[model samples]
Target: MLKEFKKHCDSTSLSAVCTQLTELSNQAFCVNNGNIPKWQSALDDVQNTQPGKLSFKPPYIAIDTKADVSGLTRSLKKLMPWRKGPYQIGALQLNSEWRGDMKWDRVKNHLRPLNGKTVLDVGCGNGYFTYLMSLAGAKIALGVEPFLLFNYQFQAIRSLIKEPIKAFVLPLKLEQLPAQPLFDTVFSMGVLYHQKDHKLHLQQLMDVMKNDAELVLETLIIDQQHGDQIIPEDRYARMRNVWRLPSTNTLQSWLEAAGFKHIKLVDVTKTTPEEQRATHWIGDNTQSIKDFLDPENNNLTIEGLPAPKRAIFICQK
Candidate 1:
């Protein structure tokens, strides 16, 4: 993956960041994650499978391969808790916890054409959207994910494909990246609320963006009726990392304060069970948005805060 990334960087304006990126990826992938052995074993299974034709078939990011379905299922289950996809491998539908295509549908038509553009997908779980970006003709779609398991999952999928698209997921965080203006388009989806300092997060996002580059910002937001924002008293939806859920107006202001221009609030939709559900792929401890919300009142979380409503803001840096 690092070698492929270098080849990609060498071919574009991103060459300046190549060495630094390589170093960061090396350091990240080397970390001692106890689960590495199991993850690697699963990746081995993916690698052994016959090469497949990859395509975005609406709800599925499918690979048309002639492989033993039962064996493949067993192999994939080893890397369980599939969080970000609904992929089709041969005839088996690896239905993940999140129907990522639905999120793509809400944002795709609104995006600037990706053809020939250098793109970044921050917190890209297993690089699902990264593959879609590359398929959309991005010059190169670089996905940075800190979670080591997710990086391995990405490699597993990449190994199954016959042709390598210009998409690569590296085990690195946005903060670890050099503050270089490289990407033509940047996506910070489902990441901001996790930041303790939202302003710094926005600033870091701006730092890597080329002049006039577009940013597609997606994060949990409270309704304007809930006042400016909600600093979660504890947990928003049973997840501990969440920090702030800003109003759409508050989010727009933050973008303006970060020196972004032409900020546009493109979409605001509540999360639904259809998009995020408990699946066999999520493993034994299956829980989802449905479990996080109040059974008595769908509009409120179990913690009694505003339910999970996400807002998408597109702006220029």
Candidate 2:
């Protein structure tokens, strides 16, 4: 996968930072994570299965391949808590926690064409949407996720595809990326609220984008009724790292302040159980949206804060 990524990078504007990116990724893989052996074992088992054609079968990043269902399931289970996708691999349905397609539907139509464009997907869990971006005609869709397990999950899916797909996921964070104006389209979905400094995060994103590059920012936001923003005193919706939940208006102002132009607030939808529900594929910890919310009031979390409501903002660098 690194070889393919290096080759692809050499063919694009990413050539400037190709060596550095690959080295960082290699170093990440070499880290002493005890789970690596188990994840690698799962990846090996997946690679042994029959390779197949890949497609978008709505609600699934379907892989049309024949395989031993029981064996395949067992191998995939080793990398549990599948959060982003609901993939179909032949007879098995790997139903993930999030029905990612729902979020995709809300943002797909509002984008500029991705055809032949170099793209970046920050915090791209297992490259589900990254694959979609590649399928939507991006020349190359690079997904950078800091989580090591998700990178392994991505490889599991990639190993099943008979043909090489243009999508690739690297085990790296936004702060680790070379500050070169490379990508034409960049996505920061479900990531901003996790940052300690939201403005720094936005600025870092800007530094990596080419002139007129489009950024698709998606994160939790509160309604104006909650005030300009809410700095969570503790956990929000059971997510410990959540720092700030800005109102849509405040978010726009932040974008403007960050030097982004043509800022547009595209969509704001409150999360629902149907979009994020527990499935067997998510392993033993089956708790989900309902568990996080107040049993008496669906509008508030167990912590008495507003429920998870996300907004998508599109702007130009």
Candidate 3:
């Protein structure tokens, strides 16, 4: 995958950042993620299946490959707790933790045309949406995910595609990316609230985007009545890394402070069980949206904080 990214950078306008990217990718891959051997084995197992064609089937990022469904399921389950997609490979339907299509439906229509554009997807898990971005006609869709397991998952899917599209997920984070204004469209979805300094995250996002490039920023938010923002004391919904949950107005102000122009708060939808549910793919602890929330009160999390509701803001660099 790192080599593929090197080839991509060498052939595209992104060559300026190639050296830094190569070094960062090498460092990322070498870090001991603990599950490397297990993940590598899973990738190897999937490769035994014949390569197939790819397509975007609205609710699914599907592969038209023929293989034993039992074998496919057995191999894929090794990478448990699939957090981001509902993919299909032949008769096997991998229903992941989240209904990613729901998120896509909310923001897809509002996005700028992807045709021939260079795009970036920050924290892209398994490159599911990255594949969609390429399918939508992006000249190239680069996804940066620091998690090595997800990077392997991306490779697992890519391996099964006869002629995969221009989607590539690298084992790197947004901060590791070279600060160059090259991407025409940037998507930082489900990632911002994890930052200790949300403002810095926004600035880093701005720095990498070309002038007038569109940014689709999506993350958790509190309502206006909550008085601007809530820096969670512990965890918002069972996960620990969450740092800030801002109001839509507060987010818009942050974007303005970061020098983004024409910010539009496009959509605000409360996450529900239907959108994020427990599935077999999620191993041992199959807890999901409902399990994380107070059983008596759906409006609040088990932590007694306001439940998860996300907002999407579209702006220009």
Every model's Cα RMSD, please? Answer: 0.9, 0.6, 1.1
Residues 255-314 of candidate 1: C-alpha lDDT, one tens digit per residue: 999999999999999999999999999899898989999999999999999899989999
In candidate 2 the C-alpha lDDT for residue 59 amounts to 94
- Candidate 1 residue pairs in clash (backbone atoms < 3 Å): none
The lDDT ranking, best first, is: 2, 1, 3
Best by lDDT: 2
- Candidate 3, after superposition: displacement of residue 55 in Å? 0.5
For all candidates, the clash counts are 0, 0, 0
Give the runs in model 3 whose Cα sits over 4 Å from its true position: none
Q: Where does the lowest 10-residue lDDT sum fall in candidate 2?
A: 7-16
User: Candidate 1, TM-score vs. the true structure?
Assistant: 0.98
Query: Once model 2 is optimally superposed onto the true structure by TM-score, how far is the C-alpha of residue 288 displaced, in angstroms?
Result: 0.6
Candidate 3 lDDT, 38-104, residue by residue in tens: 8889899999998888998968888898889999888888888788898999888999999999999
Query: Model 2, range 106-198, lDDT digits (tens) per residue?
Result: 999999999999999999999999999999999999999989999999999999999989999999999999888999999999999999999
- Candidate 1 vs candidate 3: the TM-score winner is 1
Q: Give the clashing residue pairs of candidate 2, or none.
A: none
